[model samples]
Target: MPKKTRRSVDGSRLMQEDEAMTTGGAPGSPGGLEEIFGSLDSLREEIEQMRRPTGTQDSPARTCQDLKLCHPELPDGQCQPQGTQKY
Candidate 1:
């Protein structure tokens, strides 16, 4: 009696089928979804950081001194005690 031979399956065909099923046959570069989600996550982190308080001193003297240095064009009164801005 002669022994029967088994045929091998094509690996490339299997891979293609898997990719099609996973991506739903959408026409786009690979891994595009991951990149977009990564960008959104980073943006969310940045927004959260902005929402948090900076915990810096808000004393009138310190604020006035900083304003004077940054806005030399402003009159000394604006950078002084009564006119000092919190922001």
Candidate 2:
């Protein structure tokens, strides 16, 4: 009898998914999903972080920089902040 192939989940892939879910950046990193766990507070924090006024401590420009920064899981120029449309 042939054994069934078990699907293996990649840790890096899962981390990237979590980054997207948090809508902020990963912990210890600037300008990512930043959501430790999928909870109401973390989600709200990410939202408020995004809605921050311009020229604040971390301005849109800075966030954009992080967005532009390359990650192992993301392709070049594909890490733009959520809802950003560069048409």
Candidate 3:
């Protein structure tokens, strides 16, 4: 006969859930967030380091629409930003 593990619904279970939520992620997965922000902050710093001199600066300061891609609410594949070209 095999033994079946029992699940608790009270204090111990809540503590377990809390502990799980507090960590960055599971032990081995690279999807953990510390890596993500580190990469993105690095990219933003790279962008800021570029030279955009006066009179010759033809770039939009940052189209608000482009900035939206940085938000969690924006959908993926849309950031390639087709149809946004301005004449």
Candidate 3 on 1-87: residue-level lDDT in tens? 555456534677667655654675433553456777789998887575343311113443254444443343534332233434221
Estimated TM-score per prediction? 0.35, 0.21, 0.30
Q: Which runs of model 3 end up more than 4 angstroms from their true locations?
A: 1-21, 26-31, 51-87
Model 2 is weakest, by summed lDDT over 10 consecutive residues, at 70-79
Error of 2 at 76 (Å): 32
Ranking by TM-score: 1, 3, 2
Whole-model lDDT per candidate: 0.55, 0.51, 0.47
lDDT (Cα, 0-100) at 79 in candidate 3: 22
Model 2 residue runs over 4 Å out of place are 1-38, 53-87
List where candidate 1 sits over 4 angstroms from the true fold. 1-21, 24-26, 54-87
For all candidates, the clash counts are 0, 6, 0
lDDT score, candidate 2: 0.51
Best by the TM-score measure: 1
The RMSD (Cα, Å) of candidate 2 is: 19.0
- Model 1 C-alpha lDDT per residue in residues 41-72, reported as the tens digit of each score: 99987665444423234322334445555545
**lDDT-based ranking, best first?**
1, 2, 3
Return the TM-score for candidate 1, rounded to 2 decimals. Answer: 0.35
